[model samples]
Target: MARASTHPRSCGLKHRGFGRRFALLLMPLLVVGCAWGSSSETRTGDRAVPDPDASENVTFYPTYGYLEDDEWVVPVRYWVWEDRGLVSRVVTRVASSMAGLEPQQVETFRHRLRPFSGDSEWRQRVTFVFEDDPLGQEYQVLDERGRAPRTDRNGVVEGKVRIPAQRAEELLAAQGSQGGWLRWEAVSRDHSGTGQAILVPSEGTSVISDIDDTIRITEIPAGWSVAVRNTFFDEFREAPGMPELYQEWDGEGDVLFHYVSGTPWQMYESLSEFLFHEETGYPEGTMHFRTVRKNLVSISTWRDLRSLVSAGAETADRKYEVIAGMMEDFPDRTFRLVGDTGEGDPEIYRSLARRFPGQVEEIVIRDITDDRTLRPERLEGMTVIPAETIERATGPDAIVADLRWQPQSVRVLW
Candidate 1:
């Protein structure tokens, strides 16, 4: 205007190219100014944006791993119930999200915790559910109400609802004769036997095994020295060439593999699945896990039985129940009870063989101790195998005592 601002740097506002460069230089300043004004205005009167941290109330939420976007997590519960006279612990992983945690998480946790749970005695109900209204809201209210109670960071809520042992057992066994929540049903092992089963012509021979050290190697929690020994060493291992010997026996005779473990029925699937998966060395159809009952009656007295009965003989009741069930399924089967001298297997099997004389023809036990003072009085009529001899006999090419040892030649089918 005053001679058109004579300096070359003083570009006219009307000049489009010069104006474009000028606007570009001012763009950052403009954006900052707008943002500043918008923030001030928002603080003064406009609606505030949501605070993600404030809205998230996850302090009381149970510790869990991540989940993907838009993915639905299912809730599952592992119910422990009394099946027949024996307590059958089955996992019924439900698909609802109202229980407590997700089923996948529950299963993962179970898998992780199982190896360490070899000696746990407490039977507490574990529930899996989702984050929801009502129950989840109740958790929120409790958290809010008890915020000032000063928790121990370990999340032990003080004065929690503690159910007495008797009452808890009652609740767990309230359904029917086979009490409690019924959900999981494993396909009958016989029905699910492999399409290609290795079959030998009928010989009527059956194999019985000890539970604790013979098959499972559950490092029993004894004293620290014993615990260390059990932990570092497995008495439950399949002794050297036992599996191959059993396989060859299965190939030759109409043999059945029976595992007579001292492990409780609560460990049925844990032991069964482990043997089936990890110890595939054993013959397919010949597998069993001894189920036991532990009832705490008085201060220093507990009725422990392998077979389940209505009253008394808890362990025997469980064993007899399973053995009876097997008899019902497979009649004319002759069993040879194999056990170790260590725990109650020898005594228990002796009682069983005496009870069912026709069914149990032989009783073989591994002599677990060298102490001459502890040598058991050999039972009449039943064959007791020395531990060393049995170890040698389990090798693949070892000659069987006799083929005619089996009473009858039964039709061997898968």
Candidate 2:
């Protein structure tokens, strides 16, 4: 078993002295989701759960850390933020709920960002920004014996304990206890947030999927209005049959999922609500967002949607870097890159395929735009397929089963 793990102080705390370096001694892992219990809703303003926010509000974007002295040095990345214009009309609402605004206020905010006047969808998405995650805020690490009150989650952390490398692996080996993870439970007299680290398994198939257009029905290339309509409005439509297809892949042997997108860290909870919802039910995986904007004053106008396509090579570069790092981190594990021509996913995969020829296995690019024409030369290693064709896939291995898809007929992402 690994020793008690410690999470170093979170970012944006450079100035303080006395309460300088707090470390969390994470308890043995718990499977994320459905451990909701308020120590009883201590009300303040609209919020219920005291000053503490649950996983529904506080999002964790955990990545595996390198092994140090035989134990895995796991870094748990978490954030706490006020809804700003986010959350619900009533504090009773959580996750995807955004603050209600009148017509004038919403339009005023949208007009500052886009020349176009706002619509209902525009207003909904426009106000979807987090009140900056407080800088210089202090977070204390929980003791080894700290246990958050649990409702129904079995392994929902009764006592905290350090994880040794061997112990973590053993947990992964257990039949029903399988899946790569190291969960952290937080217990504050005021707030509650429990996050888990996605451990990089020794040998497993990893799928690095894209969010926009590829999995979610986000017509980013369809213009700004379409993108906004899709981002915040509705519970989010799946890209045809991606949710079912992804679940199939999840059941295919030992598969781990990762979503790399231009979506900012602020939208983590909202996105999580869509992806992890039992209705949509995409595999539980680590999400990596592009920008981490502190304040939403400038962005409150819903301008960030333009980054979907207009972000240029900067978008491709960031995705390439993320995918490359993943392949490098787990050389033995093969990866299937699934993306759409909606974003520069094909080009990003092309770059990585060349760099890590051995690690990157199949490149699947989905095309749904009206103008379906991608240069075959640019997508040298990718297999362009229609959504219907992929939906026909039986399992992960069958993803490229019908590679009759031609790149020459794919949409070219800006």
Candidate 3:
């Protein structure tokens, strides 16, 4: 547990002299869609119980903190917003499995960052941004008990910060556990929005689709053929059975939906619309883009000198930058990445899985036109389901059965 003596004097004080500085240090850790609750010993949000019965309105409990000896700081807070409920399902699952275990046994959580249930609309979304902290190079979340949440998530509960089973039960009873997540539940998908819907599933299956040609046809080079592939599109279009597939799998239960694309911010508007369009829309998941700029110099400048950078310059490295940014924007939920064989989608997804293996449940790769030659050998030890499309992949029970196999790494890690 976190020792009260080590907590900064600004822990409970709002907007005091150190409040802005404290908030600045902690803000980077405050992302959307994380499960949370107060520990019986400590009233921190990280100990919240599960919400197995999630509705359209999901509440997220964000855990934020920095170390006592280290410069790392985080301002974790809860945000109730609209989410596609993609990683939300995954986190809920992992959270459920780890419910009774000690905090030391818990692993990392993941999710993409986008608009929470608020002013952001279908056409354009208000992205949650993060500012840099000079006090430290590493970021960490500290529980109220003053202990860091476990990262390895192995079944040996020890030095980590967690709520006891009895405490979790008490909190769940008080908060109405939905989807197995305690303080934070998912927002209902039925709420009026611009995003499309598949036939609502009795148990929602999160759609982790690619954003490029999977929806919008963006022009890009593909070997000897024209670089322009149908998946990396500019305008959102309905791919063959994608809409129906998303709807069929759509539901209010344990579904974690996401769209992990390789498109840079240059196509942010187009990509955003493609994910939330009316004709071929699905619920909005975290939209990953390229880095704001390449190289450490660009990164430093963007983090410290955002106002000076041009929009194009920011969009240049948006892909890589967005990956890191999402960690802070949505800390509660981990991701199940879905992308295409085109471009650098595989590479990016692989890197993410590698950096936070526990957070990524699986990688679903849609093979466009039998281009196995272009595919990677593996995706960071996780199962990579290579399919032609929605039907080809989920067509029969064969593919689904294959997907049921335990990932060698996750099984070992778990």
Best by lDDT: 2
- Residue-level error in angstroms, candidate 3, position 153: 43
Candidate 3's C-alpha runs over 4 A off are 1-209, 223-235, 256-266, 286-321, 324-334, 369-414
Better of 1 and 2 by lDDT: 2
Q: 1-414 in candidate 2: lDDT tens per residue?
A: 111112121211222221111100000000011122232234568665532442223334645543445665453444432232211221113111232323433332232211011001110100011112122222232234443222111111112223467755654454223355655444433234556656666677899999988887755554433344344333356776677778898889688888888665546666776788887788888887765221223342223333432445545656677777677767788899999765567767776777888888889878764224434554565676665321211221111111222223322221
Structural RMSD, model 1: 29.1
Question: In model 3, what lDDT does residue 310 have?
Answer: 19
**Model 1 steric clash total:** 25
Native-vs-model 3 lDDT? 0.34
- Point out where model 1 deviates above 4 Å: 1-203, 218-236, 277-280, 286-313, 328-331, 371-373, 379-381, 388-414
Candidate of highest TM-score: 2
**TM-score for all models, in order of appearance:** 0.38, 0.58, 0.35
lDDT of 1 by residue, 1-414 (tens): 001112122111222232223212222222222222121111224443322222100111111111122321111112222111000011212211212334443443244323222211122222222222122211111123433232221111221122233433343344231211211121221111111111111237667666554443422212122212222111224444455656677687457665644343344444455455544466544333332322223211122221211112333444445554444444466877765544445556666666677787677665544212344464345555444322212222221222112212322110
lDDT of each: 0.33, 0.48, 0.34
How much does candidate 1 score in TM-score?
0.38
Q: Is candidate 2 or candidate 3 better by lDDT?
A: 2
Arrange candidates by TM-score, descending.
2, 1, 3
Local accuracy of candidate 3 as per-residue lDDT tens digits, 2-121:
112222222222222321232222212222222222111221364434343432221122222222222223333222233433433444343334332222212211221222101111
